[model samples]
Target: MRKLVIAISMLALAASAAFADPILDRQALMKERGKIVGGISKVVKDEEPFDAAAVLTQLQALQANAEKFDADALFPSGSDTGDTTAAPKIWEDMAGFKAVEDKYLADIKAATAAAPADVDTLKTQFGAIASNCGTCHQTYRVKKG
Candidate 1:
């Protein structure tokens, strides 16, 4: 009976610990997205002329990463466990969330494609993408403690 009691206590403690924090795979995804987007934004705004080929390569790579961030992953189909910065409205209004992602992706693609052509044009398009980040964050993310 004593062995049984100790086993039950251990299981209870383990379960409590596991439930204490929210687990999220989206954090890594967001971090990578920020790095790629931020890099491109900085490069475009500064109008630095490295080798044209190198600039184009970096722009393309950033575009590819932006394209890969699945909308579903941004707002999981399952329980969020309160871990995601994505607002509850994201899940409740799936279409709206997808539309934001679509706009964001389109902005990145256009900006990247244009970067090699004219730095001025790239800056304009990239600015549009950056604006989306602020817009989404304003509406969606809950302020962290």
Candidate 2:
């Protein structure tokens, strides 16, 4: 009986780990996006001198990541647990959530194509991109304590 209990416990642990993987992957992806955004923002805010090439590279990366940010795969039904800041509403209103994601991705792609050549251009483009990001976060993400 004790051995059976141990086996059950192990199975539960493995199940939890498997469930946690998508959450971890989503968090890591978001962090990467944040870092790229921050880097671009610094130049836009004059906190860093403008580097057109670097900004372009970061924008390209943002577009690539946004393209790969598959909400369906990342936010599976049981993914709300374990380090995830995704609100339950994501799964509840899956269509709305996906629309927001699609909009954000579209905005990112537009910004990438624009390839801001100067600080002023970057400021305008980044503002639109950031606004789209905030919109999704406001509706879909839960603030973590």
Q: What is the C-alpha lDDT of each candidate?
A: 0.70, 0.86
Candidate 1, 1-145: lDDT as tens digits = 9999999999999988754332344576677778777666666768455445666776687677777667664455664555666677767877877788788888877766666566666667667988888877877666677
Which stretches of model 1 miss by more than 4 angstroms?
A: 1-23, 45-51
* Number of the predicted model whose TM-score against the real structure is largest: 2
lDDT for each residue of candidate 2 in 1-145, tens digit (9 for 90 to 100): 9999999999999988875588877888899999989988889889999988888899999988888788878898887777677888899999998988888888888878887888998898888889988988888889867
lDDT of 1: 0.70
Give the candidate number with the greatest lDDT.
2
Which pairs clash in model 2?
A: none
Q: Worst ten-residue run, lDDT, model 2?
A: 16-25
What local lDDT does model 1 show for residue 107?
A: 80
